[model samples]
Target chain A: MIYLDHNATTPVSPQVLQAMMPFFQERFGNASSFCRIGRIARTALEEARASVAACIHASPDEIVFTGSGTEADNLALRGVCRAFHGRKRHVVTSAIEHHAVLKTCEDLEEQGIAVTRLPVDCRGMVDPDQVKNSLTPHTVLISIMAANNETGVIQPIASISRIARSRGILFHTDAVQAFGKIPVSVDDLGIDLMTLSAHKIYGPKGIGALYVRKGSAMAPILTGGSHERGKRAGTENIAAIAGFAQAAELAEKHLAEEAVRLAALRDAFEKEVVQRIARARVNGRDAPRVPNTSSLSFASVDGESVLLHLDLKGICASTGSACATGSPEPSHVMRAMGLSPMDAQSTIRFSLGRDTSQGDLDFTVGVLADAISKLRHISSTA
Target chain B: MAKERGDRDDTGMSSAENEKAQPIQGPVLFYNDTVIDHFTNPRNVGEMEPGEANGYALVGDPACGDQMKLWIRVDSGRITDIRFKSFGCPGAIATSSMATCMARGKTLEEAAELTDDDVVRALGGIPEDKKHCSLLGIMALQKAIDDYLLGRMCAEEGDDLS
Candidate 1:
């Protein structure tokens, strides 16, 4: 099957799988133990941490491994809020954040914290000025995503981070969708905390990392063992961390070339689909988007039906966010982009990756065109 | 259009494929071309001025993010006209269209009783996941009828007042 849902998760790279195979058997020792096997595991884990840090231009001491991107986000948001308890309690974020951030903010709100969800423009972009304007004396942190998972619209993280710094407020970004596909340098972006997931970059699942800059105060969300420098407490996932490092290294090496190629394929797919289909709209067309993603809406066609039809044609794509799949509600990201409810429900997202080819793009455009035409015909008659 | 599975010939093709190819013979849980057509090309969309209509009502939940405004022209307590404006998915639009068709020329009491199941049946059947979309229209229709009755009662009271 041709997979166009790379934003959801990517297949594990061969090099990453190869690097991890040895740890599952030969070096299968607890990193906390005091044996030679344990020492080997500990060394491998620290090396992986360094590689992860290198990918994001962060120091090795700043990285904290977590179970998933969701866990990373939870740790970042909740940990910081708890650490700064009784001082400042207001948090600010964009309306188009992934549920990992949005829902975490909501949970914090239930605990009496004030959350200001800033809206986006028609192209799914949150202006840096809006972030500056929303700040208050009670505001403790500003969490925004580096790139939207659905529309691929890149936010002005560096500008927003600058605004936060000027106000003495901490800045965090959920970079799960941006880390491997785009260039992410924490220092350049002025980010205090960031989230990354392994599965999104062809690494193994159940492993992710949070970047907390040195001397940043953050309380632990999970407290058990003294792992991850007392920032995150749990037994280290040695094999997945090793695989994540290998994948991060490989992704960093080919990031530019793969981005250029995927951008070409994505442009071709969008152009062909728009030319062939009536009322086809590219969401976030006016914004600076990540090269590999495209979100399109076909008028009068239900997104779920389009997804099912595309799946029938052996093309795997998604309608709106993968996190909200199977729910009948339209995407919050599209809604925040000022799209009507019908327009939001009629949208689909196709995210290309390093392995996507010209032939795959051609097949996808042809199949999508046919499916839209068929669905439109059925709609017209009914 | 339910049929006994044992009576049908099964080749190597999967059951889902067979159901897609021949939709009339199986359980109507999945949609056929007829349902897709209504959902895609929904009918009687648009709106009438609120005060000019004999009855009208707007219904939706902001929490759910679905809303609809329905209007009906009543002549002697029978619906002489029906139209709807909905902000929702294709399923909701189709349900509104189907509700309009089902309510035209019916008495206010009859139209108010139109349930989501009735709307789904009129389209031959909607997918289980999308059944809620059909309910939005049903709720709107019921509210419109209630508005019509309340308006009539107010008019009678005005006559008493005068």
Candidate 2:
């Protein structure tokens, strides 16, 4: 079977699995303890932090381990919001944020914290000037994602960062989908806080990190232990973190070449689909996107039907986020990009990974053409 | 920031990644055994030809992602032949197939009086999200009967085009 849903999660690489084997059995010890094995675990934990930090150009001191990328995003949004609870309770974020950010903003709004969700253009891009106009004296944080998970549309982070910087507002980015696939740097973009995940980058699941720039006054979301320098309260998943660090190093080393390779595969997939199917179009065709993702809309065909057919043919893909699957509602991301609900329901996302090959794409092209043609024929003839 | 990743749900399990290598069987989740049977082997499918079918009706909105067409050949006020074509999920296909089975040998009056609940009962039951599929089947059959009656009325009342 050909797997193309890397944005959802990825298979752990052999290299990362090998690096994590020792921690799971022989060297299993809590990083907080002071015994020999514990000391070794502590040392390994710190080294992992430094490696993850280097991926985003942050210092080791700024990295904090969390159970998952969702936790890291929660820490960044709630942590910074709580820090300015009484002084500045307003936040600015884009409409196309992951539910982790969007739903958290909703919960904050329930608690009387005002949130302004800016709109994206047809290309799924947020205007920096819109961020400027949405800010008020109470706007303490501006959280925009580095890239959209569904459409893979890259946002204008640097310009938005400059706006927040000039206004003295802290900037946070949920870079879960962007970090491993592209070159992402917190320092270079002037980002104050960032979130990264391991599973999306060929690392083990249940491990992620948050980069809080030094001196960024963010309150701890979890409160109990002094773990993660008192910023988070749980014991770290040492094996997974070690795997994450190794994955980060590997991703950084191969970023340029992988970007070119995946982009060619994704572009070829999109072009072939658009040419074969009369009513098919790529969702964000004109926008800048990450190399590995292609969101295609097939008019009059249900996205779920396409996904199921592809799955039957041993080609695994997705109909937008897995969280929103099986719920008949159209994707909010597609709706935000000015597509009708019908069009949104007809969209599917195909995300490639390091293991995808030209032969796989060729097989997929044949499978996709058959599925769309069959579905369209059934739709029209019925 | 912690909130963004903490609630993330990316369960990306393809067939290759699935540890259990069992072949998929039975109906999809939310459908029953009978629905699966009808979906796998639909009954009375394909069209009856415009000249052969005295009544025909196409139901459902394409934008809603489901559409069905039913054709009937009536003789002596009884349905002699009923066929259907459906496009959508398994539920849609099952309901359309079941609807044809239910209306095959019934009289025009009986077929027109068939309700969505009757189709659901014939198919055991469908999912809540797909309850409309049953309704579309009954509606198409009723409309086909109506079309037949309308054509008969026009034939009897010559020069009454208005």
Stretches of candidate 1 exceeding 4 Å from the true structure: A380-382, B1-162
Proportion of true contacts reproduced by candidate 1: 0.07
TM-score, chain B, predicted structure 2: 0.77
**Candidate 2 chain A, run of 10 with poorest lDDT:** A373-382
Off by over 4 Å in 2: A380-382, B1-87, B90-98, B101-103, B106-162
The DockQ assigned to candidate 1 is 0.11
TM-score of chain B of each: 0.77, 0.77
Residue-by-residue lDDT tens digits, candidate 1, A1-382: 9999999999999999999999999999989989999999999999999999999999999999999999999999999999998488999998999999999999999998999999999989999998999999999899999999999999999999999999989999999999888899999999999999999999999999999999887999998888888888888989999999999999899999988888888888899988998899999999999999999998876787687678767899998888887576689999999997777878999999877889998888888888777666544211
B38-149: candidate 2 lDDT, tens digit per residue: 6656677777788999999988754345678889999999999988877666677777877887788889888878788777765655777677667778888899999999
| lDDT by residue (tens digit), candidate 1, B1-162 | 874343321122234433344323345465555555555555666667766687787876443355677888998889988777765555666777778877888887788787887777666667666677788878888888888889889999999999
How far residue A356's Cα lies from its native spot in candidate 1, in Å, is: 1.0
TM-score of chain A of each: 0.98, 0.98
